[model samples]
Target: MKLNKILVYVIMILVLITSCKKDIVAGEVQDTEKKIECEEVEETPKEIVIDIDDIYNSVDIDIGYVELENLNEDNVPEIDLEYYPKDGDFILKKVSDGYICVSLEEYEDENALEDYLSPMVYRFNENGKLSWKKHYDYKTHVGKIGQVLTFDDDSFIFHIDSYQDWNEGRLINDNCYLIKCNKDGEEEWTKEYSNSNRDMLANILLSDSEEILIIGEWKAKDGKEYDDIDKGLKEELNNDIVITKLDAEGNMIEQKSFGGSNDEHVDIVGYDKKLGIIIEAISFSNDGPFAVDIIDKWNNDFIACIDEKNLEIKWIYRLVGGKYTTNNRFSINNGMVYMIVTQNNRNRQHSQSLITIDDKGNASKLITQTYDQMVDKFNSLMILQNGDIVIGEGNQYISSLRIFDDTGKVKKVIHDINLVPDEIIPTDDGGFIVKSRRQIKTVPQPIYVSCIWYDTELVMMKYDSNYNIEWRKTYDRYKNNPYWDCVIPLNNGKQITEIKTDYRKSCID
Candidate 1:
């Protein structure tokens, strides 16, 4: 009996031991599975998300509660105020001493059969004192100034277009002339060029090798009268872009023409050491040799690089398809071309694109970016020394600046209500200077209606390296300054701006 009881006890103990071993194995297996799951989670990559709203919110800083003025108290030097014979276009340029203001004048009578246009040149000293004022009286010749280029040697040149009827054969055509002058406003030499029956100068530039490049539109005489523009003759005329190269002595060296059956117009001209003379132009013909590579059959703008040595086209790239708005800007840095193209799409949607082209004319990169609001146009483009690009955009309600990196990412944005940037100039202290126009509403007086007249004020704003506004100034003429022509930076960290003062009040309907 005792042996049987002991065997039963041993059997019970064996069963208990087996149960304990199974429980241990189950727990080990559960822990191993959990370790594997954790490893899998760690191996998976996390998606990166960039919040554009955060970026915008971070950089959109308030300028201030009040608009500050940093302009020098000396004010724009006032010169001898002369009565304008007639309303005509004028251009103001910065000189070593002060400023040069040139305007075209004509007789007050518009219906006169025989009249002449005069080129008026005025030089103002640094104190707004008139140094010399003169006008070229071209008898029986209609004259207009295209551009005035100033040199460091106290000399200047003016690109003039003169229209006259030849006394020999009664032939009527326009002539382009380069009039060089000394600092004393004395004419040095006058060089004349006749490309076609009608020649209109667009832009002029001085190359690194001291060659002068003149680009303009040239049209052959098609048995039309000189003043036939009243007959809507522009549609029937074939306008070709002509580029003429001249030496320092005002002697023509070479001339090149580019166009098709349709009309072509030049918008901008720039020069680069590697790309030579770069031209941005618009083409309306798709079947012509120059327009063959155009993307569409209608309006298109393109960039062409011409070889400086051979005076031949190096490469051309067309901006695929869209109606490019005005104020298109471009800059060349480190032998690369950076352009800002604002286009109005067919669907009425406006978009701005940043294009980069290499020396081989290869448009390697295109970054199409749009703002939240409907973008009107990009007015200016500036390439910094650090390969960063700064673009200015202005619409009816807002004006802002966008800074982009080399990869075309928006790194920063600046907003200012009172600033509508016309030009963005970078300063030497790693900051920026923005030149813009500000519109102010004058208080109503007994003589004029309330809120009907608006005055244009030229504004200049300086920013620090951190993109903070250092100072803002408005060159307040206070009278009837309706137009802000241009602004130039002076060496002493000051700015000189030109305001076209018309005493006649302009009414805004």
Candidate 2:
């Protein structure tokens, strides 16, 4: 009986062990299946490589050329005038064939004591050659072209500040003019806009719905009439910011003005659907027209967002503590305003700061770099879609391009470049293009005379997202003859510039 009981216990223990072994094998199988499934689902993605040659070869950039020597002089009003290259702004717009440019020149009659403004428009072909040149009839009035906007059909309109009348035998620019022209350089219509005081055009912007927004300054006339023209008249005057909305047909729909007891000048403007009109300006007054209070009594640089519908000042952010501030450039991204400004300290030292202003009128300086005495005049600011900020700064002494993250941490910098960027434009392919100029040579004439000539070439550079230079092209065909100001890119991967020869200077006797 004892042997039989021992046999039964042994049999029970063997059965339990067999059941445990079967459960362990099943758990191992399930674990293996999960591991295989995870390995199949978590595959790594392939890296993308961008070919620089592909972008350059995409467009035929060397097809057409505009001969600067052969200017279209047809329909130009004849005058025995001495043309001088004026230091002004140049507006370039790309069309289907090429580009159109409008520039201003100051000319004087032999006997006249003062200089008058002449507006010149030029057209270039596909590869970028001058197709036609048009000179407006400025015999009756002195004026300068402020901005140009093109339509879908290649027709365009430009803003102009023209002399309203001969006030006491002096030509005063007291009115703003909107002149529309066809594709072939024919004037379609001319409209005049003026106020009780002198009006000057600052900029022109188009809304999303194709409406025109004309920004200018309206200054109270000093009420004193003069007999001679003053070249530096605007320096002594103060003006209020004026915004005039017009239909596509150059018809004024609404007009408004904003200012305080002192001077306010608008330098840059941007439009956003949610944020309304963004304005970068320099203000001198502490009250009136400002949505926020100004603490500093000196010249303060500010950023303001205005409601476009009713022309109300939404919010104004003044950059305090600086004695004098000057805004160079600004860009809007992700509901934030980023700009580059130069300010003066108590020791008379100049410093450049990259400032960010939020939508709620809050301002912060992201980075600041001080200059001893000479501040850089050529500066550009742009924010990429990926939250990277690109800033270009250069003087005659040095130049550089820097890329920083959203937190103002430096990512990459192309320092001590030979070219000075006149403008920096973002590309569609996550890169940027720089329109710049390089001083090729400098020739000092006879020591007895203060005659120095500089030979410069217009440079166009394309950079990749990693800040690697993809391609660079220099336009050195004009040498020391043509004086060009700006360069603009076209949709077809080309660039166009208007070359004006300053007839007033000659190194050779």
Candidate 3:
């Protein structure tokens, strides 16, 4: 009887041990499954995660901000005052006085100018100080003046018209001119262009022969009188590509016009110094309207033309397929041209396109990247040394920074640059600085450019080549000022900023 009892006890003890071992094994299996799920979910886009390094203190340089008078001093936010507005175009130039001149296209007013946005010029001193400013308008046009080119130490030149036709050709008084102004915003001289019904200078840069090449458009009737656009108005629509060349002393050297009764425009132009030719690209229509929202008409093509002093085309090649929204820049290398365009799929508003132009000016789609990435409208892109392309703006995809190879492959996905890219300057060493934004919340959140969300204090940061934060500077959005000018790196670790009359520096330890 004693032996039988002892056996029963041993059996019960063995059973209990087995049960406990099974429970331990189950817990281990469950933990393994959980870890696998996390790894799979990480494949998601970076846009969903808040970067760990986005809002950190700077280490290298201290940021500075300042405000100047002669600006709108109303109920305005700090960041938005000097920040660039939507569709806000910019031109960074070095003046003879060693001052950096940054120009931003005028923005739309809530009051709509009631007509159109007028062009306002903000000037900065050599030390990145905001000096005097001015607003210009035409007697008839609905908007203000546009970008100005620094000609000499005391004066600059800009383009505008009295008839603000909103890209429509104007007649009689509809003309484009290069107006010269002194440092105090005083008018010095105005060089006008006529014969072409209407026109506006889109951009101006130095030419091969050390001349000033102005890229713009001019419109005239095929004698059809543009009856197509009557629309009950007596005026007609004259669409043409008008290019005017000027000498170093500000004299008109030549002018040329292109288009066929239909609509055409030239967005940019440059002088091929090595080839000793003036090259300009203009879009012309062979067919009528387009069915695709992203592309122009089916028959529309971009022609690369090289001309002589006689204003005649020497060689021309018509590039096909691409749409008009492509803000492409052409570079002439060793007997080849590099044409890069910022493109996206028809399904979304943002994407990337990089094309290589052969010696014959033919476009080969070298690399393309398209995904479910959402980005702000006015982003900036620069070509890297290794032939990679870097883009900056508001990224809606995974993380923040995306490095792409020439074959459309993503080399790196940076959720946080540790700094925002306010301006992306492609360095020779193959890195970039991000001028990003930061803010302080006050009021009901004021309107902002570069971002749709409103904020009071906007922080502009700098990033290194490896996406490291170099420095971050914060500025106050002012009431009257509605645009952020430009942020430049200074010699000292401390940087200088030119906000609307409020120039101050920040200490980043």
Each model's Cα RMSD: 27.1, 29.2, 19.2
- Write down the TM-score for model 2: 0.63
lDDT of each: 0.65, 0.64, 0.48
TM-score of each: 0.66, 0.63, 0.54
- Sorted by TM-score (best first), the order is 1, 2, 3
lDDT of 3 by residue, 108-176 (tens): 456553434444566665554556566655323332244556655556676664453444453334555
Clashing pairs in 1: 77-128
Worst lDDT window (10 residues) for model 1? 443-452
After TM-score superposition, what is the CA distance of residue 455 in candidate 2 from its true location, in Å?
3.8
Give per-residue lDDT, candidate 3, residue 6. Answer: 48
What would the TM-score be for candidate 3 when compared with the true structure?
Answer: 0.54
Q: Give the Cα error of residue 30 in candidate 2, in Å.
A: 99
Residue ranges of candidate 2 with Cα displaced over 4 Å:
1-91, 96-98, 101-141, 152-154, 163-176, 181-189, 194-198, 220-238, 291-299, 323-327, 343-351, 369-378, 394-398, 440-453, 480-487, 497-509
**Candidate 3: worst-modelled 10 consecutive residues by lDDT:** 55-64
**TM-score pick, better of 2 and 3:** 2
Candidate 3 shows a clash count of 46
TM-score of 1: 0.66
